[model samples]
Target: MINNNSVTFIMAGRRQRRRRWLLVTGLLTALACILCCFMLLLGNTIYPVNEVLRALSGEQINGVSFAINTIRLPRMLTGLIAGFAFGIAGNTFQTMLRNPLASPDVIGITAGSSAAAVFCILILHTSGAIVSIASVIAGLITVLLIYIFSRGCTFSIGRLILIGIGIQAMLNALISYLLLVGAQQDIPAALRWLSGSLNGSQMDELPPLAITVLLFAPIVILLGKHLSMLELGEQSAISLGVNTDMTRITLIVSAVCMIALATATTGPIAFVAFLSGPIAKRLVGAGFSNALPAGLVGINLVLGADLIGQFAFDVRYPVGIITGILGAPYLIFLLIRMNRKGDL
Candidate 1:
């Protein structure tokens, strides 16, 4: 039944897909680099690339040094790292669950982290490491609860998503209640963080997020093939000799840690996690893993949205506002399409 012509055609198609994946991924990486450069060079005062480089190299270049080192660098790093976390995490959940709506942001994982952070800010009057720690812990706890409740004799993606959305609603209500009773002075800080501004990002705050991503990203990437197999459903993954349970747990844990740290840092930048995976999947096509591409796409969206927010309007909007504006219409479109397909 095997034919040389069919085999040859299949091989050619495989090669073409691989080439496309490489091309798209390379371009995304280049664009992200360009955005990073712009983040450094184009601030209140525009500095030339050479001056930015010199400043980065520890040269005392007057105002450029402080602006680049103290302000822009940290902001850029925060967006870059956080966006990567969101993208990869979002993609992992969507792929594993076979549903776009399963994103941590959509499901209430971010809300759980946000709720914890807000509680720390309002009730406990805490900041720094305490808030971040609480966020990570809360995110883990939230996902654990979702997992426990959604499991039965058989696992159901539908049940998990429903539970997640319900939890999100409850957590959001808690956030609102906290805001209502909290001190007026603390409200402004909490609101700014909730809106996900990169403003006031400091170098020291970058380490926990940066280290978490660095540690976990490789694990995700290494297991990317197994993750893709998981997209075929549990039985199919098992038939393919993949340890579905271990793979799922590894991915969920890794993704949750990264996203939680990111939420702690950026206060749940809207929809970056939700949008990155599908976009990356479309770009990279079917054969290759979309994890890295998703991360790159996330970097572009966050940095691009931040830039638009900063300069596109008379009043600078927070990054979350820009991303929210971008994501809302897509969400509506997705719902309509899913409904048309009887998937809702």
Candidate 2:
């Protein structure tokens, strides 16, 4: 009962989809690159591109050298790496759980990191590496707790999501309580971090995050085929020879580490994680792995929003504020649509 015409049409459609994915992915990469350049070149002094390049090359372009090498380069690198981590990790959770609301931002993971970082800053009187280390550890523990609780009868994605939201609320309340009880002088630093600013990014803070991403991003991508199968639901994925438990565990740990490291570096840059996956999904369409594309979208969002925050208004805003402004409306729309479809 097979027909050549139908087969031909399907092949053509597949080819077209591939083309679209390539085009969109390439465009996203180009935009991210442009934004990175702008981050380096358009600070208070506005160094030219050639000057930035020369400074990066260690040629020392007078005033441009310090600003470019010390401030802008670190900031740009932080945003780039952190954005990719958030994007890829977010997409992994969303795709694996088959729910947009499963993002770490919505599901308590970032809250775990934030809570730990805040504790370090306010209670322990810590500043640098201690806060980052505590954040990563706390994030991992949070995921483990969520998994254990959600596995009562069987692993249910809905149950995991609900529990994550509940945990997020509890952690947020804890954060508030800590803020209230902490020293008044430490409050400003904690608040600035909670707002997710890149105001004082430094080169020394980049290594752990950069190294984690370099090691884990490929693991996530290499597992992308299995991830797509997970979208077919657990039973179907098992039938298709996917090691659902191992795959999910690998993905969750890898993503959490990446995102937690990012949170450690950038203080949870709002919804770059939440927004990147859906945007990449929309841009790339179906049948292609979205992990890389989502990362690229995240890079663009962070860099673009940072630029907008810096220059678009009289007073500068953090990247999180701008991304929150962009993501909130989309979240509202998605909730409404999901409600109508009975998918909420």
Candidate 3:
């Protein structure tokens, strides 16, 4: 009788979980649809929803097919990919470190990519694929360097964060130096790139990003299952038959690759990486979940931010700047709240 009661409780719990999952999934889907409509409606000349739908379906409306297909579509796609990448990557790292602030942007990866790309732009006269390559190299190298420097009896999150901040400071100085020495004509372009604009992303840049995310996101999601296991602490995970070292490394490498690819395309975007995971966790009612909700939330974040950037302000700003504007305060609030709770 007791065993039967336990089984009944388990079944009931599973049903509850399924219900919650469905509800969250439904909300996410609804948000995505709303964002898509907003994206179609918000740009200059403000197409009504009906006309935008027609244009998207390859039907002409207001002679705007060219503009919609060539310009708006690419921009919208870029936002979607960048946001999704940032969100998933951010959550992965945070979950790995078991800390909220442990995002790629916070940990020097983005700064590294930004620094290398800026240097290439200012000195090497590189553009396009070459710059993308440089960003990936810089990001990977920065993380590897951090790992090397921090290796001792074991890795410490505090050490990793401090080292990353140091790296960020160094990269920022280099950026300042480049701007000082750079020609006036190139300065504006460099600044725009640094500010993380989707202004110039062409459809050509889309394939690599799309393919990278498509190939790697599933791996990350699968690997993310080990996260809650890993979070039981390394020794505990090992005791539970989890290959802690391999799992950690693979998860980190996969996530870094996604971030590098995304950053290479869109210039490290801003807080999308840092913000997505927590938002998703809150939305999904926390505890321990993997990458799916975070990735979806990421898509929502970028799309929502881009729409606002394009239309919310009097003058257009890059999605990066808008995210920074929004994310920084939230980060500070998080920090303060953590401190108050003695988690800091």
TM-score: which candidate is best? 1
Give each model's whole-structure lDDT. Answer: 0.94, 0.92, 0.81
Worst 10-residue lDDT window for candidate 3 reads 282-291
**Candidate 3, residues 1-344: lDDT per residue as tens digits?**
99999999988887777677668867886898788767756666777767777788999755577667777888878878877788888898888888888899988888888888888888887777787778878888998888888777978877787788788888889889999998888889898888877887788988877887888888888876588777677888888888888888888777777888788777767888998888888777644474778888888878887778888779998888888998999989988997899775
RMSD for all candidates, in order, please: 1.2, 1.5, 2.1
In the range 279-316, model 1's lDDT, one tens digit per residue, is 99999999989999999999999999999999899999
- Name the TM-score of candidate 3: 0.92
Ten contiguous residues minimizing lDDT sum, candidate 2: 43-52
List TM-scores for all candidates, in order: 0.97, 0.96, 0.92
Candidate 1 has a TM-score of 0.97
Q: lDDT-based ranking, best first?
A: 1, 2, 3
Candidate with better TM-score, 1 vs 3: 1
Pairs that clash in candidate 1:
none
52 Cα displacement, candidate 2 (Å): 1.5
Once fitted onto the true fold, the runs of candidate 3 whose alpha carbons sit more than 4 angstroms away are 48-54, 57-62, 286-288, 341-344
- Pick by lDDT: which candidate is best? 1
The best-first sequence of candidates by TM-score reads 1, 2, 3
